[model samples]
Target: MRYSSITDRLADLGSEKWALHIRARQMQASGTDVIQLTIGEPDMPTDPLLIAEAQRAMNAGRYRYSNGRGEPSVVNALTARYTRRRADVTAENVLCFPGTQTALFAVMLGLVEAGDGVLVGDPLYATYDGVIQSTGAHRVTVPLKPEHGFHMQAADLEKAITPKCRVLLLNTPHNPTGAVLTADEIKAIGDICRKHDLWIVCDEVYEELIFNGPFASPFDDPELAERTVVVSSISKSHAAPGFRSGWAVGPVEFASRLLPVSETMLFGVQPFIADMTAYALTHDIGTSAAMRTSYKTRADLIVEGLSNVPGIVPLPPEAGMFTLIDVAGTGLTGEAFAWMLLEQEHVAVMPGSSFGVEAASFVRVSLTVPDTVIQEACARITKLAIRLLTPKERRA
Candidate 1:
């Protein structure tokens, strides 16, 4: 038996990235005192209002097959949300999907193909390379340097562009690094995209998790609106990951063009979920602000706890629920450090190499855990780092 080329293309995408996380879960299941901080799932529970909305819709018989576009409730809610940022947005500009991952998949499939390129920042979201590969497009990475606070540089984007590049995939409040682009930075990057005629596909699932300042996107710029597609969901914002409700907002023409691709992949999300999403979007549900504070506090805990520890440097995030700590000073690659930390200290974190080469000497710690877990994890991490340091290195 044989599989399609898509399997071959994604053979080494990111399966190994979860090995430590899986091991951590196995240990935890056996009652090991493991502090697992590898994933970014929100610790907050989904709001009852949203759940009731789904129940109401289901009882009202919304379980029937829906049109490919989306139920009116979600479509309208998305339109109103994006329209406030850009006046030209309309219902036709939005297409609902199961989640940000699926939206990115369909959007990439619609935008690029074999022999094309997707220029994405290194240390990107784990699934991005696979999404690009599924469309037969190769990923061209632009480094998001730690010196730049992990933000993507406009000049770097300009330098990385090639004729084969058709899309610039970005994850703001980025995964692993949690670097958020400022408004001016977005303008500069948008200028480069405008000049090069590249499609901007932004993954903004963490849009509401910003701690430093306002969130900015290429889709917020009127001039680049035609070329920008913003994909987001309630997973992070409303603490509704289980609902799997997300959407893509782009030009009307792009939505019109991508609908069939989306329909082919998934005709429409569950109507009850769409209704729940609508309520989540329109209401002033308090999850985003709450998570923002909680995650920021956890990040600060990591920084404060590890600042004086030998052979480790915690990079506090500007936004999002994870922080990257450079472990190069420990004289170990992130993978080795991560494995040792889990084995010796009973803690688990994602190695930076899992994200990209740029973060090879770093490890990503999730802020999704409670403060106590974060504090304990930091102590364990510090213990491991200090143990790894040679007496000579410690003196220096």
Candidate 2:
């Protein structure tokens, strides 16, 4: 019997972040005190209303095949949610999926061909590269500079686009940097895409997670609305990662194109999850609000506490639960700094390289832990940064 070597796409991809997360979890399981800030999972519980609704559905024998597109109520509630945000959405534009990750993959597979180029931001969501590679498309990363506050200019995006540029991937408030793109900025990209006949897939999974300022989106432009597919989920908003509920919204034609790919991949997303998600979307406003407020408070605490630490610049994030610290001058690589923090102070942070190529000198710290845990982690990191930055002779 002969086994096959993995394809180059799978063979070449590396996931240091997942490995670190797994190791951290294992260490914690062994009773070691590890402050995990690597993954983006919410620490809060699922919305109680959703739980109750799911129980009701189960009791009513609602276990059956889902409409491949999604539960009608789920789609309607999603339309209501997005319309409230931007006023341009309708239920027909929505496509439901088991998870935002799955929705995103479906969008990519539907839009791109083998060897077609896709533009993703650096530092970006790490899983994006894998998705692009497996789709047989080339990943062209547009660097988001620290000096520019991780904001990409329109001209920069133009230069990154080639004839093969089939898709432009965007996220806001961005994961590591938390830079939210303004409406004007979005239009600029929209204009470019419209000119070049390129499609877009905006991953707004963190849209509701904004910390400061109003959210701006490419979908806000009606001109680009048809070509743009927005992928979002209930996981972050409701603290229900296990629920596996998400949706994709675009013009009916574009939505229709993506649905077949999704159906082939998943047959359909779980209906009970969709039913629960609809209940949560309609009735769990309080849960989302409370979690948002909680994260905002945590963000403030970490930013204020870490401000006093020298040689580390905490770029204030406008949204999302992450902060990217400039660790270039620490005379240590981001990975080294992260491992040192883990070993010496027992705090685990994801290295910025996990996101994109240009974030090598930065490290992302998430605010998912409790406030006490956050304070403890901050103090520990403060001490570590001080030691690393302070002169050896100054240490008494």
Candidate 3:
């Protein structure tokens, strides 16, 4: 039997991260008590109000098919939800999906083709390459510098765009590095993409989790908003990932642009999920706000621990649940460093290479675990750092 190429592309999705880490998971499953921090999932409880809303929807028999777009009120709630950050948005501009990851994949299928060029940031979200590759597009990575706090540089992004570049994938409060793009940085990207006539796929799933300041969107401007496709969800925000709810918003021409392929992705998202999602979007969504506070505290604790460890060069993670600190100074390769920590310390963290090509010297540690777990993990990591460091290396 012959298998299609699309199936091959889809199969490689996130395999890199999991391929090497499966042994650790197996060890964990065998009663090793591994504190897994490899993924971005929050460890908090789902918003009770949102859960109750889902129950109400299920009770009301919202179990059938949706209008093939999404429930109207859900769409409207998403429209109004973004009002504070970007005032120009309305219900007409929104699209709903089971999650942001799928919505993002739709953008690729809709606007990109086998030979098209799609620019992604370096040290990117690992899934970006897999998803874009699934679209049969060329993935052009624009590397971000460490000294600059992984902030997207204007010139690098501008230089990366070519005539065939039709998509610009942007993520603020980025993963692995936890770097957020400033307004100027976002504007620089938006301006260039618009000038080049490219579709900007902005993943704002972490928009509501900013620790230091307000989140900015490319949709802040009318021109960019017109060309921009916004993907967001409750996974990171409301801690309701099990609900499997998220949405997309853009020009309907762009939003509905991939409905054909999306229908193939999964027959429209569940209606009860959509209804509860609508309630959460319209409701207070206070859980997201409260989680942000806890996240900020954890970030501080992690940074503090890493800072005191000899030969560990750490930076503050102002957003997201993780930090990318250079572990090269300890004389261990990224792969060896991560294995040593997991095997010796029994604390599971991601190797920097899981994120991007130039990440071999760094390791990403997630802060989603409880305070005690984080503190204990920090102790083991610090011991590993000290053990790995030579007297000569520690001097640096």
Candidate 4:
């Protein structure tokens, strides 16, 4: 039986990282009560305006084959949106895709190849390894420390860069840890990339989910414009995940070069979806604002609920929909704690190790759940921590 090498590269990189989540779903399928906080599917529904736009387009029979570049209206909307951030952004710089994941895949394919190294922050998003590997490029991790609030430091990026490195895969308002890069941080990292001649591929899927300060990215800097490519989607910002609408905004040349790569993967996103996306981008549908408040509140709840718990310390996130809780004081690795929590407490959360080495002793709880569920999950998590760290003699 012949199989592509990509299958091997992705063999251990796939569902294994999601084992805890999968197990949680299985338990719930069996009628078990589980407060699952593993994945970051937005709790909010898609805005009615966006849905109506999709419906209108579909009724008008906008369901036709679209060019690899994207539908013109959607492209224009993206251009206008990004141009506001960086005045030079135009239709030529936009390439629409199904989601951030797909846009990243195309960007990787266009930027690196076999024997190349991708400099990424440790404790990166789970699928990043697979994405890099699928392109036959190896991932080189730069440790992101807790003292830095998990933001990738320029010094770390400089130390991790090698002659073989071709790209810096970055995520801000980052997944798992939710650390948003400051403007200065972005410039510093961009400077390193400039010195090393590496392309900056940033995933900004959570751009609008910020709670601390304004969002920042290399793409926003005119100096880094040529080398920076930002991929984002409405999945999080607009609570429109099911629509599968996303895109890559980079230099016009990068978009031109990546066109074939994108076409090879997907001819183009559904045109009707593009119309919905355009509307989502241009209109203030209130989804991101609502989500920002909700997720921020939930993050606060997780920290407030577990901060003084016996053996767990919840790290507050600056942005994004997940909070990391360090379980090292409980004498358990994140993997062990997550499984035990699911089994003993009927609460499911992702083990931090699922992301990367730096997060090994932490568990990531999604803030996408209802407030009551978060409170209950925190209570149960506290109970488990107390039981684990308490003296056996005290537990009659």
Candidate 5:
């Protein structure tokens, strides 16, 4: 049997991060003390209230397929949350999915056609490149510079826009880099997208994980609300990745168009999970606040520790669960550094090249690990850097 061209394409998009994670797990199983900083999932436990809500729903035998759009309860809860954040959003604008990745794939397939250009930030979430490629769309890269806090500038967007560019995929409190867009930057980028008549997919899965300052959404600008589709999930915020629940909020017409695509792909999210996610969103679980505080402390510790290490420049992450450390000073490519670290110190991290070429000199370290574990990992990294940076003859 032969597979379709799309299936063949999917093979090339295999995630380097997950591959490293798997290798680390295998090593750990074999008695290796591997400190994992590869995957982005929160190490925090899921909120007990959310767990109770789901268990209660299941116990009531509410396991039937939900409405294709979403359970009314979940949609209403999302609408209310968005309404508080942006007054323009209503129930009609919300569509639920099993996960943000699926929501992103559905939106790309629904809106983009073959050969259409999708402008995305370089060093973005690695999975996005695969999503764009699988949709038969071209990915137009706009490099995010460390000097700019790794945020995309409007000028760069304008320069990257071509006649074929039909969409702009934006990730705030971005993956790998932890660069959160400011209100002014969001509005400016929105203006650029509006000028080019590009559809905007704003991945705000890390919306609740902000540290340095307040978060600004593209939807904050009323004019962009109609053009922007906000993709978010309970995975990062509520520490509920196992639930696989997320949502897309946009214009009613857009939601209507995306509904069939979502239905065809997932049929509908599990009813019990939807009910629990609704409860999680509506009720105060105190989980997000706690995760935020914990991650901030972790990020600060890692940053300070790495700063003191020779040949490593750790960028202080403003938000999200990871930080990109420039390892060029060690005279090693990101991939080589990651491999060496794993082999020498048993610390598994993602190579920056996995994100994009622009980050080839860096490696991303996850902040999801415990403080003690992070400290140990930093110590190992410091030792490795010192060893690598020292003159061979002098060390001998």
Candidate 6:
């Protein structure tokens, strides 16, 4: 049977991170001791308090379909949190989804039409490309340069925008690069969007994982509140990817338009999960703080270890759990280096080409492993680098 063109559009949706993850799992199943750093999932287990709260909710028989927008408590908690950050947010402006991925996709589909241009920075999360493609929209890229600390500038945005462009997708504390935008940078970008009359889909899922000072959001500016849809989740912050709960905050009209799309996508988040998530949002849970501290330590270890290695250059991460390493000096493409590292050293990492053509000379390493594992991975990488670079006649 022939499928719709949408199926063809999704042909490239499989991400290299997940591909490496599956390969690593297959190797491990075959008894190989692989140190997998390809995926960004936290190595730590879910917080016990969250687990207990979930259990309590289930025991109380809270299983039922909730309002498609969200349960009142979850909505209220999110509303209060965002309102505290920026005075324009309220419960009516929030919409919950199964995950931030879905929230982002829904927002894109709701706002952008076929042939419309969605401007995104290059070296972006792999899924963004697929999401934009699935909507039959154009994925226009603004090149992010390393000299500028990988932050997107308003000047670049102005240059990238065109008559067809309708949306600007921004990710702070960015995945793969770990580049966080400053408040001033966000304001500049927002100003550009305002001039172009473009909507901003701010992916702040890694907001809580920042190593720097306080997290900054475009919504912090009330003027941009009408044009911005903020997508976030506890997947990274609380280490609860399996729960698949996330939310989007925007102007009331924008959120109301997104709700119907969300409803058609997945009625609502599971009620029991919603209850636990609401509790998590409202309370001062210490899990996120603890995880942040641990991730910072791990980031330091890996950065320092890779710095001593000869061929690879590890960029120091400002926030988020992954670091991008320039692998061009090794005389290998990111894909070739990733495969060689996995096969020869039993260490897995994501090829930078998975993100964008601009990142083809790089590879992303996740700091999800423990300190010892990170140390060992670095050692293996260094040894492999030496072997690959050594002259054959010198070996004897």
Per-candidate TM equals: 0.98, 0.94, 0.94, 0.98, 0.97, 0.97
Which candidate would rank higher by lDDT, 1 or 2? Answer: 1
Per-residue lDDT tens digits of candidate 6, residues 1-396? 889988888876864446876888899899999998988898888888888988998899878778899988788889888889987677889999988998988998999878999999999998998789889998999989888888898898899898999999999988878899998999899999999999999999998888868777788888898898899988888889999999989989998878889999988888778888888888888777777787788878877888867678888888888988888888898888988999999999998988888789898999888889989999999888877775862363
In model 6, the runs with Cα more than 4 Å from the true position are 15-17, 392-396
- Please write out the lDDT profile of model 3 over residues 156-210, one tens digit for every residue: 8889888888888888878878888888888887888877888888898888788
> In candidate 3, how many Å is residue 389 off?
2.6
Candidate 5's C-alpha runs over 4 A off are 392-396
For TM-score, candidate 3 versus 4, the one ahead is: 4
* Model 2 misplaced regions, further than 4 Å: 1-7, 12-15, 83-90, 389-396
Model 3 bad stretches (over 4 Å): 83-88, 391-396
User: Backbone clash tally for model 3?
Assistant: 0
lDDT by residue for model 4 over 1-396, one digit each (tens)? 999999998999989989989999999999999998999999898888988999999999999999799999899999999989999888999999998888988899999999999999999999999889998999999999999899899999999988899999999979989999999999999999999999999899999889967888899899999899999999999988888889999998899988988998889989999999988888778998899999999989988899888778899999988999999999999999999999999999999999999999999999998999999999999889888965862363
lDDT of 1 at 260: 95
Clashes of each: 0, 0, 0, 0, 0, 0
Which stretches in model 4 have alpha-carbon errors above 4 Å? 392-396
Better by lDDT, candidate 6 or 5? 5
lDDT of 2 by residue, 361-392 (tens): 88888878899998998888888887885566
Model 6 has an lDDT value of: 0.87
* lDDT (CA) per prediction: 0.91, 0.81, 0.80, 0.92, 0.89, 0.87
Model 6 compared with the native: what TM-score? Answer: 0.97
- Mind sharing the TM-score for model 2? 0.94
Q: Candidate 1, residue 278: CA error in Å? A: 0.3
lDDT of 1 by residue, 90-139 (tens): 99999999998889999999999999999999998888889999989999
